[model samples]
Target: MPFLLNLLLATAAQAPADYTEPDHWLCYPGREDICTEDLSATVIEADGETSVVDFPTARDPEVDCFYVYPTVSGDPSPMSDLEADETEEGVTRTQFAPFRTVCRTFAPVYRQVSIQGLRQLFAGSNKGINPAMAYGDVAAAFAYYLENENDGRPFVLVGHSQGTNILTSLIAREIDGKPVQERMLSAMLIGFNVAVDESGDRGSFKNLAPCKDERETGCVISYVSFKSDAPPPQDARFGRPAEEGTEVLCTNPGDLGGSGPAALDAILPAAAYGTSGRPPAPWVKGQEIKTPFVKVPGLISGSCMKEDGASFLLISVDADPDDPRTDDIGGEVQVAGTILRSWGLHLHDVGLAQGDLIGLVESQAAAYRAKD
Candidate 1:
């Protein structure tokens, strides 16, 4: 009779039969028309200077990266269409494409619960939107990739926000404790709280523990970033250590240990800010007209700790007054006219520590290869 469970049951009862079909995928290997190489981003310096940065695309990649994107749909409907839209494109360009420097990327577009659906769910109106429907599509797509394209190779699983929710479930149901778990390099479930006990085991996942060190393979790395001085709100969606003996897993990408602050390798969309050097409106299409991504190194630092029963990654930045690199990276999440501070830096969860995440993946890939 739990609210979420009831809603999920309702959604399953009404889901269409074709919901799990793979032909409707937005990104797959069969689609030769889609572009998946020569990924690039524009770099913005603290002094208002700009330059181009390109990621390496491998021809015979040793590892594969299966990614599920966060909630980027603005459609009023409960579920998003399978086609690739501008929002999806923007997310991929900023979040997933950069991984091309390491593994061959494979992203799947599912009928994810839309922005409106998320609002409704948080507002206590499930409206028969079952996240399982979305998970089904992801599961099918992942299975297809594993059987057809993976060829028994080691792979990494990446997801953000809603995508994280789907991937978490997928790992629990499909990957955990199975033969495929041996080939898993790592799972980057960002922008979401993954619960664990004091010993770093027992919640969210049965065998997969938090990544204790950077090169730790087959482990999970998850965190929600917030301002260094800001504590997560009591009602925050993420970082809430729900049970009496539980702690929301917080593995700072900048510093794996719950130790001192470390510098961030910030990557963002060039269009995030306008020509006038002001933060623009959401989906302001024109702000970053030419650049697909913008990298600002040494711009931020973060650390992980527990505050008021909530665990989170606290971020900090020292902006030079004379520098034009702009301190704002746009990672806040606002709901119902109120910004959720405890959710930490929801917007830039992946970008804030992109370099560290990529580095971790590369190391894990090498480790896995060595063991194989």
Candidate 2:
């Protein structure tokens, strides 16, 4: 039985060649000239296939942006990569330096609210989140862009789950009080509990109010979703009521609202590799299948995608805590903020829902008209 287990492990070990380079545009810290292969591939043969795909339409040149995505626990490659480069003599060994990872695996979850405890979520080295660590790379990529690219153009910030947790603190630290607020578009924080506390400010839009009018700027467009009307647990402030009169804002760029379920049914291509050697399995009775990238939501009011502009777009993609995906993902809010109460989907695939993801970005981006 031990030998069988070892064999299974061997089969599960992913080949380095099998790992696709993460896309630069999608990377958090900006790699302005960097590019990766098309992530939309459908099949992988043992024999190689090399096909240069078409260039995607360029993203808005006027917009400056930043993003931060945190990786869950037990995954090490996102923080460190061992690579060999050739020099004059032969192969040279090089190691990348460590980046910040907050909230170690054993960190405590709170029963009540406090800012100090929340800030701990962004400190330390081995912030423990297991099964996968995709968000850290996302956050790092965005941080890089904010610091390097973006020549002071207004920007947006979006995150889900751990990504949201990391960015929430980032807003408090980096962009919240700085002069950068003038160029800011909006911050759409999705899954996490983002309250203003008793101390309020003109910039802090955490008071459950919607961005109702077109002229409204610098407000947060945040929400937490639930299947039933019942409020989610204490950790999340998103799923609560929309302060009356305010609509549950949306922007469906895919133009699918009247089209119905068929429009939402694009089949997402399977990612070639996960933390484990095997790619994620097909959507079974209990598994969450990745939705394909077709048309996503555009910037429009009362749609899944929000069209109006703000300085940042913060998102919190909710997941199931009891599920194995949340096991390595340590934080008090990780367990308390799960929106997927009944679905048994992998947390990793939740971020890739095409209609939801693209719609969210495009809708936010579309809101800002170019300043003369």
Candidate 3:
């Protein structure tokens, strides 16, 4: 008994908690930092024509979107600070900004495990402090949001990569099977693995199921995009079922099992560049654009398939061979160069399917409202 007590004390000492509630976040109502208005973008048509697409600047939205960003923190520490940085701002502008058209946006700044810490976790050395701290902050921020701002309205949960990890746990712990589950329109958990049984029962979630169709409410829309020809690594971060005889959930944003090729819509950063800045023609390096966001249509197509014992969204571009804009979009990572093939389009998971996800959310929101 003495030895067990000593061991518990040692473990507790190693796992020190150093997280604080986020005093400032991106999604606070009536805050100057809230980015839900005047989202203008430059649209480049296939015929070399350019136009501006201005989104609806609605403030009193009927629904809400709660977003959690990926692991873009370059902080040398194990956990990131709650304050927003350039990486956070860039991700919000490029990824979450477009969703404002559908619902009011709320993003909490959590002390996520840093990139370095994630690497260490993946290496199987450090066990729990980083993720525990990150999730602690996320939970606190979420509780505060629900109690102070939710007002019993419906909401959509959005997350990517590490953010997905936190939301998956959050749903399992707090939302699934609870009364709040009815209020969940959908969860778009991209760039991460969500497992399910052979019968499609819960793996990571209890009551929530993978979205089988576009208009399915209270379900999950998730996938890791990869080129059709590229197979994921055996050690890929997503798409592997957690237990034997089960399959990872893969819902193709395009054609959600019922139709023709989905018309792809994309919103990219103003500083967007192809792999190593060698993208095909119309997309030139350092090209100036008029808007903070760039919208490209008919540039990509997607499907869901199983490969290398993992499920993934297969992305294919229909760019004309003669068109300079036909360059293949590559995944972005912190590797400082072209992302490795094994990564399998990790970076473009959100960008490539942004349009499909938005459409899904819109449809799901309507379906949820219809239930009332």
Give the C-alpha lDDT of model 1. Answer: 0.73
For residue 170, model 1's alpha carbon misses the true position, in angstroms, by 1.0
| Distance from true location, Cα of 2 in model 3, Å | 33
lDDT: worst 10-residue window of model 3: 1-10
TM-score of 2: 0.43
User: After superposition, which runs of candidate 2 have C-alpha atoms over 4 Å from their true positions?
Assistant: 1-35, 41-60, 76-147, 196-210, 213-217, 228-367
TM-score of 3: 0.86
Ranking by lDDT: 1, 3, 2
Candidate 2, residues 1-372, lDDT tens digits: the string is 011112223332222221133332322233322121232322211122222222242343444334332222221232222221121001000000000011000011111111222233335322321112232333344454556555666665654434455555556656666776655666555444344322222222332233433333444544433322222333233332223323233222223232121222122233321232223333222334232211112111111321221111122222333322211111112233443332112232223233343343344445655333
CA lDDT of every candidate = 0.73, 0.31, 0.70
Prediction RMSDs, each to the true structure? 4.2, 15.6, 5.2
- Please list the residue runs of candidate 1 whose C-alpha ends up more than 4 Å from where it truly belongs after superposition: 1-23, 29-39, 45-50, 273-290, 334-342
Error of 3 at 262 (Å): 2.9
lDDT of 1 by residue, 180-275 (tens): 998898899998767788876658888898887876788899988777656777777778865678887888887776488888777766554122
Per-model TM-score on C-alpha atoms: 0.86, 0.43, 0.86
* Preferred candidate (lDDT higher): 1 or 2: 1
Spell out the clash pairs found in candidate 1.
Answer: 46-324, 46-325, 225-345, 233-342, 271-288
The alpha-carbon lDDT assigned to residue 194 of candidate 3 equals 77
Error of 2 at 207 (Å): 10
